[model samples]
Target chain A: EVKLLQSTDVTGGTFTLLLIGMIGTAVLLFLGTGWVSRKWKLPVALAGIVAMLAAAYYWQAREVWLTAGQMPVIYRYIDWLITVPIQVLALYFFIGTVARPPTGLFWRLLVVAIVMILARYMGEVGFMHPTLGFLIGIVGWLYILGEVYFGKLGEINTKSASETVQTGFFWLRLVVTIGWAIYPLCYFIGSFAGGVDEGTLSIVYNLADFINQILFGLIILYAAAKESATAR
Target chain B: EVKLLQSTDVTGGTFTLLLIGMIGTAVLLFLGTGWVSRKWKLPVALAGIVAMLAAAYYWQAREVWLTAGQMPVIYRYIDWLITVPIQVLALYFFIGTVARPPTGLFWRLLVVAIVMILARYMGEVGFMHPTLGFLIGIVGWLYILGEVYFGKLGEINTKSASETVQTGFFWLRLVVTIGWAIYPLCYFIGSFAGGVDEGTLSIVYNLADFINQILFGLIILYAAAKESATAR
Candidate 1:
């Protein structure tokens, strides 16, 4: 039988260091990407997703590390509220960087992100029944997920774009689809059984953010590099 | 401010009749469609989705009508457990009925339906926190929606198939995507607000099943007939 592992203060320190390393790496990459291709939108937006996520993660990690005993759950939600929406915007920029961007896509994506993030926040903060708030949030995530994989990214995948563009879109969408799914799975794990406690949840979340925020950024960087190389 | 609408016993009778009417229609349509197209798989699967949904709805309606005051929520989950998996099959048949069906498509779709439906049941049954259940279900749903719209249906839409096949998939997919979203929305609404009682939820559910089951079947019938005409 699988059991939930209770993390100790030592493990907490290790995770905090990891979080700092993630943030420092993200900042360095963001600055480097910005310098490499300020002219391109995708890389800039990719940098933006990492920037906010790193900030959120770093801040939360510090707060949790400094405090003793059980960490405050609200810190995680605060990090998510600040970073998750920005991540959605990064996805938006993926489509927008292409010429003749779809009309109303930006606002629509933003609305979904805001609704999802806020509804979840409300639930976490006890403004409503957690389940119902979560349901609303799920509804919002469904809308964004539908538009991303089914609607926009599909268009990008099948369009008459060049080989490099198509390759970039294919890999980018794959990364987003696969990597982002881990967040919710981890969420379910945390919420479902008595086995996984807050500390493990934090570790898993921090690790996931490291991948989703940074590894996700790697795809766009490659794409931007390809785009810039051809232009020069 | 929006408030949840409570339903009364008198209204309950009307919805019970509606449920019976829905079941009766689905039965009649199933018989008629079975006679019309035994050779085709899509219509058969469409018939199956309706047949189970009608039976589940019919059983639940009878119990509620007889019991008067209290309702067992498990009946609804039972219904979903039986019907939703079939509904996924209906979606698969939409693509499966086409020439050169994709590899491993059936198992993937089944896995998604099972994951989605079971997670929902666990949440409703209080076996797990509803939020985690909802998230897992959403994950399943997003996967299915992605495949149906962006992945497979898009392929069905663009391929050099006969006009009849394309039209069938077009209408089928639209009905599935738009019509199915409402069930989750209503579910969230019912779960979120105390004002909307189970009766109103049942009424809305019966009404939606009619559209989703019978009305959805009608489209498949047209497509089946068209397929038959071309076959001859």
Candidate 2:
């Protein structure tokens, strides 16, 4: 059974922002679902995944909204459990659908992203020694970096015919490396170093998720839209 | 006098990564310095500021490496004090020197950036209520956004001759809007909500700083380089 230490004093702002985040994602999900080509529809599905996760967050969080003082931490992780894996898979979908990389590179990219997200979930939930899990998480991140910078993925990006793929790959890699660095840092300091309170930690995670889910989905959508236009 | 509550344990990987991040910026600084023209020198100086900041972090973080349980909180803020103004100034400089936007935009952008950073700093150090500070900071950020998206700055971008300016501005603005939402979240949670520990807070700030400093510098350098060739 899932456990929640409920606080009846929930902040209106978090709930409000969670709802706003959900609605915004929902709009994008609709764009992907309604407008995108069937040949290039996965980005929309990826956006849909985020919308659902945001909805999941809103539903779980809002249910205890009146009774809970803080949003249930477990629901946040549960959202990640399903959403994070999908998010990584979405990136893999992007690499294949847009860049159309070779098979080995494609598999490696997907594997690294999965490992990174899974390890992070385990670390956060205390299923693993948090620091060790974080280290493993870093390894997964580093592996992705290697593929983007020094591996065949880099080669594919260099030679790709799609302008969107060429341009998107650079910024996508930047977003992944620099933006995602915060998670491990959070683990190291907040979870391991006794540095932050639950409120601060949740805020950081919320902010990161908003950017990660929304901005990343938009980029995928932009690329898919570009590809669809060209295909037509 | 500077005070540090010291700990005997140090994380070698963080220290090492900080060092590497610094070195990477240093190389960019040198490239901007030695290769760029006098007309386009501010971006190089911005890179120099980041390299110096990385050095300052290394120096401060390494000093208590053997005795400190965590990285010094004050030094992190201090680094921001020195670097933030320069980063804003760099943006102004890039707009002037590269995009060659009209005169008022330069000053407006600088003023907006400075006001935003100051509000955020004051909020972080507790001179004002965190939420209030964050909102004020957001105002400044929104001003920049308005200028870039709907104001004369957008007009300037459309007319700018350099491909680098066009390409760089698109991504740079995307970065600013997306990347900066974290600060307010941190303030709201850490300061307002009474959640988050100093260590976790520091880690978030550090990761944001590294990404903010390095990636922002690279975009400026790319623009400056493009502009310099045109001027030559």
Candidate 3:
């Protein structure tokens, strides 16, 4: 049997931190929608929805971590499976205001994002060779980065007249780049390093998500509010 | 070691049913908000929010039920802990439109509702004696019934002038009385009786929630839509 690290005060504290951050951010995004212009409302609200879903998943995660004294891998993946696509789509909605996205851009990004998550999940669960899954997952993430930063969407975003939109797109893209990179790094260390325990990985994962998920939405909200103020 | 029922096709299918019901209802309630008037919008949308939260919880519950083949009682209570209060508040919001609810009515009902869920939860988890917990839970439920049925809120309902609100109040109270009874019945069977398996109790609980959660919201939506159409 694989040995699991029992929960310590630190891990439990981290989970609580995650829980509060997600719920607080979710409520903020939802309430913040009223302050933004109509066009920005959907993206902001979608982020709120994603945060709400994450908050619910973490509710169970915190309970399991504290009570069962082990991480349930399924909770993390299930959370990503639902929330990640919505986060990606929040970006789609954010840009739809300033630029007409190319045909198939939405579907392509969604499919790739799902594949990225599925690849990592299959690897973690031993359904595929870990190295192969990691490679496929990385490829999927890189494709997304290319699409948002250098591909057709990126071209549209560059050509768009709205400075607010352009600035927001830059930060959102950077988050998907640098902020999301934590996932693969965690995967590598947790699965391949053979030294770190689950508790450490859990805390690291929680912190990464707390930053990425909330920061992604905050960038959009900032742009939306700025745009709204200028328009008014 | 406690024996766990191996997941079968039937149990798996039931979980899928629960998952689909929750998500579908959540989406429906959310989208249905546009059809209601501004006064009724919060309560209708609050129901949607509740359904959304329920969908997230069921997603996790179904995963554990299908894979672990055992009920995680904590998932049920965690779901209730958050969703139940919002649901109670939904009723409070609904009645606020038609009647000036008495002072302390909201807090009293909310506290009793929390007490009800906590008592049963503690009983299930062995934090307290099961019979004593069961009795406290029953007492809490009865107090809520009294508050809504014959206490100040119910008295206001009887004196209300709006036919739609009065009719809606009648059905909503029935749900609280008859629909919510499923919990105590399930708790009694699962805890006190020695015969029923966890699988059986899970199926019962899922079905009960699928009905209670959706039906509670639908009744509000129906009344709100009717009132909106008539007023317009």
Using TM-score as the measure, which candidate wins?
A: 3
Candidate that would win on DockQ: 3
Supply the global lDDT for candidate 2.
0.63
Which runs in model 2 stand beyond 4 Å of their true positions? A1-12, A62-66, A71-73, A102-114, A120-127, A230-232, B1-232
TM-score per prediction, in order, is 0.45, 0.48, 0.57
Would you list the rank order by TM-score, best first? 3, 2, 1
Please state the CAPRI-style docking class of candidate 2: incorrect
Q: Write the per-residue lDDT of candidate 1 for residues B112-216, one digit (tens) a residue.
A: 887887787677657778878888988888888888778865676567376876777777677667777777777688676545776666667666766677666
Best by lDDT: 3
lDDT of 3 by residue, A1-232 (tens): 3334345578878887888888898788877777887567768877776777677667767777766677755556656765787788788878887866865988888888888887776776677887998999999999988888888778889999999899999899888888899988988887778768888888888888876787887888889889989989
Report the lDDT tens digits of candidate 2 across residue range A183-214: 66766776568867656666666666666776
> In candidate 1, how many Å is residue B141 off?
1.5
User: Candidate 1, residue B60: CA error in Å?
Assistant: 3.8
Compared with the true structure, the alpha-carbon lDDT of candidate 3 equals 0.78
**Chain B alone vs. reference chain B, TM-score for every model:** 0.82, 0.77, 0.91
Indicate the DockQ of the complex predicted as candidate 1: 0.01
Q: Which stretches of candidate 1 lie over 4 Å from their true place?
A: A1-232, B1-10, B33-39
Superior candidate under DockQ, 1 versus 2: 2
